[model samples]
Target chain A: MSTRSLYVSADTPVHRLTARSKIGLATALSIAAFVFTTPIAVGIVLAVAFGALAWAGGLRNLRRVWFIVVALFVVGFVVWPAFTPARGPTVLATPLGSLSSYELRFALGRSFRIVSFIIIGLAFVSATSNEGIVRGLRSIGLPYAFCFAVGTALRLFPTFLSAADTVRQAQEARGLDLSAGNPIERVRGYVPLLVPVFVNAVRQVNDQSMALEARGFDTRGERTFHGKRPLAGRDWIALALATLIVVGTLVGRYGFGVGAL
Target chain B: MREVFTMWRDTRMILLVAVVAAVYAAILLPFKVFTILPGLTSVRPANAFPVVFGLMFGPAAAWGSAIGNLIADIFGGTFGPGSLGGFVGNFFFGFVGYKLWGNLGPLSSGEEPNMRSIRQVVEYVLIAVASSAMCAVIIAWVADLLGLVPFSVLAPIIMVNNTLAAAVLGPPLLYLTYPRIKDIGFLYPELLADEELSAAGASRRYVAAYGLLVVSLVWLGVGLLVGTGAAPGTLTVGLVGLVGFVLVLAFAIIGAERLSAILERAGARPAGRNR
Candidate 1:
């Protein structure tokens, strides 16, 4: 059930970097992406990142998680205008109708910014396991409770997704037409599904807590994690390169004006 | 001795609650087909489950429901202005439910909520109304505090809409769903009685659910009373802020037994049976 097209390309240099460095590199890229809202700058960074993904895995990873990026982009570009009081930079002109140039351009740039981060997130998931991230967080002195919650959430995502599927199917077998109903009818249809899903979630949490206790989860005031992935030299170098890419963009934005990007 | 409440011997109940929680997450998710609320809308019905769970299970259930809400938000596409607003709003939403149900009882497995009594129903209404008012006030204050949006913009509409939505939606949802809660594993009567021998290491989440409800409600009351900077919300004034939380505590405790009946159907609770 945990199986899927892995976001992390196998045996790649970026994939091999210590998760700590990767997270740092990813954060730097995100900062650069956020700052350089200029279309040209965003386009170039997106292209470079996409190229890296192609080289590491294939066009496949990009295709698989592209939906998330697109969703974020649309929300920032389209939904924000309607909801927020402040209007975005205008960018277009329509002689006959209501569309304008300024608002359009600003939306496009915002879209680019969000999509760029999604790619960064993809880099995170594709390169490291959830355990790696958890250990990295704990080692870096994040609260045990917080880190544990994250780890459990990630670890259980696949399981929960699968459990959901199982229950959905079981309900369907009992005359539940999951796909064909009005929104209200469908919500009511979900009654059968909710019972089992929550029962399982509660059961799992209880099980997980017990499992942790048995493994001495709360035995000592401090806890140590194993399976620490070491930072190979190649991994560090890739990380440095990633950092430089972002730093260059930021420096260009604030120091040299938008043109530097 | 109290820790023994966690065992799950009844396979069906455990299976049911887990499945219910998962499905509950799916349904509340904004992208989920059944989303009744529109894009960026805060009112949601699926909240009753976690509220019930927290009241039944304790603080963890509160956290779980909160997480579930966040999950739904992210999957629906991370709404930028939404991140903090949604988190706090939903947190209090579930928190109020937990506070109502969790602490009012002695917060132990054997102790029941007197569900058969209409007094419990009154308690539920009081808890629901008080919690709703508190939530509405905090959401408005916090929204202003963050400067993400202005009170001038949001308060006029939200103040009225939220109060009505919470009071109306919260009680019916609880009433309809509360009856089914006993079906969950840890609360199974058969297993609790037969497996009392394994009670030593059992988890007290079930008990804590009730106890923590009382404690958390007090926190909510204190927050509401102080944050409003006035008195109980009315017409245009909305929630008025108070200085000390004494009134808030009084509201929670005085209404404590009258509201937040976590121990309903005490004999029906399946405390030590959780495997």
Candidate 2:
């Protein structure tokens, strides 16, 4: 099975940064966007995210989500402010009554916030591998078990995708017309397909468990790993910058009321 | 808690979690419902994973659901900050289901569901409803606070979608797999009950589940009435409903226990088997 997910590897500074620092920076920037919803705050986050995207060579992957982002952006620009009650002093052209400049700005800010989030996410996933995710999460003080579970899930995703495809093909061969129904009917058509797939997956759980145990998976207490990359000064700098973004957003919003939209 | 942590770390359990997450994400990613809102919420039979996997693998399933939702977000083209919310909320989606069933009635010993008892069936539905509400409340609260969507719009949709999947489809699936997994000696939560439940804790969980059911029903009513223009004040009603929902979930999750003893004492069942 192909190990194809959202991940794309490129040789760049952001990509060279450990997964832990990338995750930290992206997560903090995303959270800061949420915490401070003003245009200035969101713009700052968006700029950083775009910088990361450029550095990580994630811009190429933007094609995959362009349609979705554009659709959401249009909706946010047009519909959200029309529905939102809050308004500013200046009035933008309201084809319908009572749309204001503030609502438009706010809506624009929101769209930017979402776009920045998506960019940061794409950058992180593009730079990091399944192993990187497990190690990074473990480094950040998550339980080792949780980290393993995350890594395992990433690794198994392609296998399950293939299995689902095989099940769909088999059902199609059996004359299950999953393609020829109305929307609701089409969804209902999936019931038969899903039931068999799920049952098969459930059945394999026991054997899989047995296999793991036989391979010394049950061995506990003080385990050693092969690829343990300790954090370097560069990683610490990234962490500090991420932490500063979060802390600065909070203090600015509450202390000085600088960026509270 | 220590024993449960060990279960998650066990290699076999980790594999089980991985497979569960992967399958669920794969099934849901392609068919996602792209809303005007910018996150991954889909018309999912994949919702079945948390219910089934939770029963089969315990805490491992909770971790799986969390990671699976993240993976689904990435695949569905909506991975973002909201996914942090998605991860936590989806974890409870499985955790609540597992915790609710693991110690309830005949399942207290972690035996396979025989489907012989009406009370157990009702309990499953109650658990489904409460868990759905729990997920909807937590996620919508964060989303609304961050100005994604109003609580009224997001909560009802999620609550209805999840409950319909779990209630309509979960039991038959659970029944079908129970015997097979038991035969294979992989029916999880096999450990005898370790936590000593005080009566108060048990009653609180019962009350909480029941309260959540009623409050959610009323919240749904308010949503319907408002949608049809029969009622005004949606935001007010929605905010109120959200508060009530969160309070009840606290009771359900934090003070959790089996409701079998209470139901039997209330004369719902004439005979209590194997007490």
Candidate 3:
């Protein structure tokens, strides 16, 4: 029932950058993770991502979700190699198959890549608010209506979650045993819970739409914002750095064959 | 295709998008504990929301599902590179059901969107499965391309998860809500201008689109089996599958655009709101 978002309020250089720049940096780091297939290259990207997270003061956020990070890392490091075909020198013989050093390196690199993505995503979300996301996307030239919908959706998430919990409680009070069923039965049990929630939502749409239209929601022409801030010099520097990282990784991976597993 | 963008113009449709996004994400958040693959996917009973909402609200649900899944990932601690794929995949997960529901056999003769009859139920299940498979392919393919996961491993998992949720929960929810929503004059077709709902070239163009979809899915399915069975960890097969997927998806997009253009040319008039 916690309504808090991942954004941690702080005054840091990473937090000072605009959401658009953070988004760009995250994208660049993600692409770098995907492009680089060598353990060393992936490790470097992971390091940079972690460094960004630390700079954003969001390292605690990473600690909060450490279980998932560790689980994914384990899956990638231990389980993924089993799916990969053994190649190069054989490291060990097991009942399933012979383990290869090449597969181990591939697994390690993949794990690092996934971890780097997580860190970059954490850094971005930790520094960006829901309004910031909408504003940043608008600044990046997405249509106003789409951005408005996204912002509204984010704002409504907590409200809907609270409503759903209330409904679940009311249903349970009415003898709806949600936990005492098999998987299919449990899924079917959701019908009672979902029907009322959805019906109520549908009913609200009329009122909500009327209210929106009353506020000149359908008005056309250029709109002005109350607190719009143009991207500063630091924003451009962040953008340039993100572009450099992506282009550098791309060139290193394909152009020079530097990161091939 | 036009409705996808045009829905943003209608206040009701835009509100529906927000409601769907909020509802879907809210339901999805609690289910994060049932993780089948950490940071990738889970046993998502919330998957049913997209199909049901899609059938009721049309293209708004498509956008909603995409945004909703992204929201879930962002809050649920699973957001990552693969989430880009999840966004697009969940859009089709909601989209294909509504698109095919009214266009496919038995239901293609301009039937109202309902789950009243056995034949209609069959069609619904078929659409759910199709949407589920399409969603799976898009996500698994992207994951494979990104080297995050193998296609052969992830596709079936997502397919089963989505189809099971949609098939189990879709009918009763749709049966209960469709009539009420329609009565309230909130059905997508009721809210939009008739030009937005124009059916010109729909049947033929959809046939082409669905035909290509089936073929591409089959191609990907075979590639999945080969990639997993014959040669695990091979890039060539995955690349070939990607090419076929992209080619077929491009044709499907073209077919949809042609349908939209034809509808625009036919100059369908608005069916004024009954309310």
**Which candidate's DockQ is highest?**
3
DockQ of 2: 0.42
Residue-wise C-alpha lDDT for candidate 1, range A1-261, written one tens digit per residue: 023424454887666677777667766666666677556777766676566555556355556545555655665666333333334444444574343444455556656765665565555556666577767677667666645555555455556667767887888888888557654454455557655665556556556656656665642266665666676787678668777867787678877897331
Docking quality class, candidate 1: incorrect
| Model 1 lDDT on a 0 to 1 scale | 0.48
C-alpha lDDT of candidate 3 relative to the true structure: 0.76
Ranking by TM-score: 3, 2, 1
**lDDT per residue (tens digit) for residues B254-273 in model 1:** 32211112232444433333
CA lDDT of B260 in candidate 1? 18
Name the best candidate (by lDDT): 3
Tell me the whole-model lDDT of each prediction, alpha carbons only: 0.48, 0.65, 0.76
* Poorest lDDT segment (10 consecutive residues) of candidate 3 chain B: B257-266
Q: Relative to the unseen true structure, what is the C-alpha lDDT of residue A86 in candidate 3, on a scale of 0 to 100?
A: 78
Tell me how each candidate scores on DockQ against the true complex.
0.10, 0.42, 0.57
Q: What's the TM-score of chain B for every model shown? A: 0.52, 0.69, 0.83
Off by over 4 Å in 1: A1-6, A56-58, A65-68, A71-75, A79-101, A179-182, A204-208, A238-250, A259-261, B1-31, B34-54, B65-93, B99-275
- The TM-score measured for candidate 2 stands at 0.81
TM-score of each: 0.61, 0.81, 0.90
Whole-model lDDT, candidate 2?
A: 0.65
Candidate 2 C-alpha lDDT tens digits along B107-216: 24333443445665676777778677766766665665566655555677788767766665667667666666555545443321223222245555445545555554
